[model samples]
Target: MIVIVDYGLGNLGSIKNMLRKIGYSSMVSSNPDEISKASKLILPGVGAFDTGMRHLTDSGLLDILGYKALAEKIPVLGICLGAQLMTRSSEEGCLSGLGWFEAETLKFQFDGIAGKWPLPNIGWRDVFDVNGSPLLSGFNSTPRFYFVHSYFLKPLEQDIVSMNVSYGFEYACGLSKGNLHCVQFHPEKSHKFGMQLLRNFSELT
Candidate 1:
């Protein structure tokens, strides 16, 4: 079974509904027992970086989550703030992240020509699957996903980047490294594209 990690944040119901719509069953839980039994894990979150990490720490699922993702190497997906938590740190907060990747989350600083763009880039934007990851499988045309954030990821290793997006300038929007994967957009709110992406994730071994 797939377990959506409920760390006091995220669109849990929306994610569960999307998964169900795609014919995949999932449970929302913060229980370690339920999480340990999961074949795959989806770490979903929103809100401030420090707060998200604090909630996860307070939930006492961090150790098991780390074990599952790092030791057991289960298929783990992180979304939005969850994705940021995977990095080493973030400019938005002083707290250390999950450190799944050698990356950092940075706030969008518009200047010069880029200054025309607004903060908290909130809308559907085009995404380029540069690496053609299986997570993005079956996308015939250019795929777009719903994004609502003021921060973006800057991975040290570019090869791990699966998708890139441009608001004022290009930045990594999706990442894939072995059994770990993450996306900056909200697939649950993305309609057909979201459904297809979630379906693809379900098919991952």
Candidate 2:
């Protein structure tokens, strides 16, 4: 079963509904034991990164995830702000992240560009594969996925980036380091491509 982390941060209902529609068994809970038992763990988030960490820390899930990720080596997938939280830190606020992936969340400097691409990059856009992650199996190099975020995680190694998308500039749209994987786009919100992506995640060992 897949466990969707619910820390009062993201759209828990939408995510649960999508999973059920796909005929996948999943549970949304803050209980550490239940979360640890999840065959695949999905960290989905919305809103601010710092607030999300506050909720995770408040619910005592930070330590649980940290231990499970490094020790057990369970497959953990993070989406959007959830993905950003997997990094060591962010420029948004004070709270440190779960630090599952060796990366950092940073605001776009729009290198040489006159203006920023736009905050909260919402809507459907193409994402191309970089690291050839199993989560993107059968999808072409550039497949569309729903996106809605401001900041993006910059992983240390090129292999950590699974997909790349262009806004004002190209940034790491998908990332996977070890058992920790993350996507800047919203697979649940994405249309046909989104559904298949979720299915691929369930197939991960």
**Candidate 2 lDDT over residue span 20-123, tens digit each:** 88878788999998987877888999888889888888898877787777888888889888999888899998888887777899986776886656776778
Quote the RMSD, in angstroms, for model 2: 1.6
TM-score on alpha carbons, each prediction: 0.98, 0.93
Stretch of 10 with least lDDT, candidate 1 = 109-118
CA lDDT for candidate 2: 0.83
- Model 1 has an lDDT value of 0.93
Best by lDDT: 1
Segments of candidate 2 deviating more than 4 angstroms? 114-116
lDDT for each residue of candidate 1 in 1-205, tens digit (9 for 90 to 100): 9899999999999999999988999999999999999999999999999999999999999999999999999999999999999999999999999999888999997776535788799999988887887777898878889999999999999988989999999999999899999999999999999999999988888
